[model samples]
Target: MIGVSHIVVDWGTSSFRLWALDRAGAVLAERRSAQGLAASAAEGFETVLETHLAALAIPEGVPVMMCGMVGSRAGWVEAAYVDTPAGLDRLTEKAALVPSARRPVRILPGIAQRGAQGSDVMRGEETQLLPLIREGFAGLACLPGTHSKWVRVEEGKVSGFATFMTGELFHLLRSASIVAPAVDGAATVDPRSEAFARGVGDGLAAPDMLGSELFRLRAAWLLEGAGPDAALARLSGLLLGAEFAGAARFGGRGPVALIASGPAAALYRAALAQAGVATVTTHDAEDCVRAGLHAAAVSAFRLERMSA
Candidate 1:
């Protein structure tokens, strides 16, 4: 067991998830907080960790490995994004193993994709996908979130991926947009509505027209006298439906797996079902960043042994 303690931290934009693990990857103690990167920008990063760790009573001298925005350019340390088609070692090569009095710390790097056309990067979801790596699944893995990702995993290695700003758009439109003025903040999913299904159908049919169509949610309500409730449902449908349609383009005919374990995962499941696409969803399970950290840790340990 190395006779030493280890802590895996998945600190994202909005929340922090920490797990104290044994040598066998078993979680010994777990803690969570609202002190995410976005929240801690005003306060220093180390203060956020100190406050949470003090609450968790985490003793000193625990080896800690972190994933997510904690390694972003604006996070705790600036970690470079590892290019696609790269292995764990390549990603970790750019990670800075910070000196600490408590224990050795390692931060997982985000993944980046660029071309003559443009570029995109993921701060956290890449870590989650690392745990999903295995043989025989030569298709795409969809991780739905503020920025949903469609990762192409071929023969257990990541080939490429695309990120869509679906979640952020949904949040902005639902609350900030004027289309659904009275849209309830605590609305629930209504799977039976044709409005929702219509949004999905239209989105799947023409995802490229998404920019123009988003206006329909409000126009359908304000101009056509649609209800707030209906507009809300349609808003959710448009995004999830668009994601389903856009993500499907990556895998083509092969099977697709949704790896996220949260509310967004549930919405995606329902959307895929409405689309008649066979799908599976996982909930309240391993966090993506933690899974990615574990994967990176194993790879690091293997490399360390190999070098020895």
Candidate 2:
């Protein structure tokens, strides 16, 4: 509480997370909510942020560093994208300043990839990748979420990456598609289920059969009497397996480094194993983002004065 020098925010499209941290990068206080960028845009970014800060009794003039959709065009302000082959230094160098804030506020820039494969971009995930980049990590990394990203990092620079809509598609299919009825309960998947393993096998064997396999979930439930839980688990495996199959096309030969948290992390780990893709390491999503934000804050605000 005494040395708290900054507040870090990870403002995603549908969620908001804030951390009050000491100069040592240790969390002093925290806040989270459903008031993400979209919702904050409606209620007002400053108002929403202030309300949360007020509730936590955060002092005025504390430097604030934010990442994610908060920097998007639709959020508080546009923090432009840093092109591929970027590193931590580039990200820190290009951080955008928010205009007219009572306190000093900076939004970390997202990384963009553009070329013959069209264009792709990520906002908050770049922050999560900072620690790895700084450590000179070189490997394939997977960050699973609503839009999962498979990245190629070589010697501390992000060379290329691809996004998969597996999580989004799973949400759509379970909530709005014909498989909705068969995907009852809490929309959860059991990684240990045989049905899940079978689904992964099916997906890895024939990724192109995604459409037909999705239909089979409904058919299996309607005709073969498969339970809703099994159906849900199977659907999760199938989608995740399909994502792995697609990522394999990129020719990443080594074990993958999985960056995720909670349920998504468990699910991805299981699916990757089922698909025969070994995981060399795992990093907690929360820790990675916080570490990245802290690293950025150190460079941006010169926190080394206190931390040292």
Candidate 3:
């Protein structure tokens, strides 16, 4: 409260994280909650935002900067997408303003690929691309999540990108499809599991045979009594493998980089290794998002410089 310069937020579909920071980006205070876009939509976006603001004792005049689904068309404000082959700087310039708030609030814009052949849109993940551009990162970057995004950066701009529903598909298949019984009581997926490796091989080897491979996991449970752990790992590997299979064909200009913060880091790393991609540089997901959010804050607001 005393020395805070601005507040930065990462408001995703099911999670909310806010930080009070000085001009130098050192966090002064922090808050995290389950009041993501969905919960905030029902509870009232401003109301949800205010509750946290008040809890943090965030003073009036401290502008708030946000990224993620909070800026989605279905969230607080529709922070339109900046089409591909665009500079990352467009994110800060095109940020949408949130109206009628206690203080100035803005949400960063997402990126869109409008090509007739491979049209796609992504929100929230673009913030993760800022650091890459800032560092002169040129090549492909794989950011894994519910909807994993593989982006191509060239000449300090996002040239092209692709998205995969690997996580969502894995969840749907395990809970709602015929593969439920096979993974119902499954233990955590072992990165080094033999079944996992086999599944990865199965996917990369036969991309067109994915449906059959998924069904085979269930069949293994029925006849050979394949355990839950193996079943889950096998399924995860299959999905990730297929995702990479398609992504690999996206045409690479340089080595791959994996930006992840959680278990996804290891999972994606292992999957990449299995797919014969062994020269990836790994960056911490938190670092990239924080850098991106701060950069957006700087661009959208005239951040006050702290005194020496």
Best by TM-score: 2
The Cα error of candidate 1 at residue 279, in Å, is: 2.8
CA RMSD of each candidate after superposition:
3.5, 1.6, 1.8
Give each model's whole-structure lDDT: 0.70, 0.88, 0.84
Which scores higher on TM-score, 1 or 2?
A: 2
All candidates: TM-score: 0.85, 0.96, 0.95
In candidate 2, position 173 carries an lDDT of: 98
lDDT of 2 by residue, 1-308 (tens): 45778989999999999999988789999999999777898898888888888888887877889999999889898999999988889999888998968887899999999997659999999899999888878889999999999999987898889999999999999999999988777447878889888888888788999999999988988998788998998899899888888899775334988999989998988888877788888999999999999899889977766344
Worst 10 residues of 1 by lDDT: 299-308
- lDDT score of model 2? 0.88
**What would the per-residue lDDT of candidate 3 be over residues 1-308, giving only the tens digit for each residue?**
68888888899999998888888788888889998777799999888888888898888878888889988878888889999887877889998898877788999988899866389878877788888788888888888999999888899998788899998999899999999999999877888888888888887777788999899989999999988899999999888878878887775323688889888888878878777785458988877887788888877786754233
lDDT of 1 by residue, 1-308 (tens): 23324667888888888876656566666888788887877787767776666676776655567888888878877778887775555665666575542446678788887784248787777677666663245566777788888778766666788888888988887777765474555366575677678788878888887777778766665677767667777777888788877677675224567776656666777677777776543423365556567656655544334223
lDDT winner between candidates 1 and 3: 3
Q: Please give the distance, in angstroms, between residue 202's alpha carbon in candidate 1 and its true position after superposition.
A: 1.5
Q: State residue 107's C-alpha deviation in candidate 1, in Å.
A: 0.8
What would you estimate as the lDDT of candidate 1?
0.70
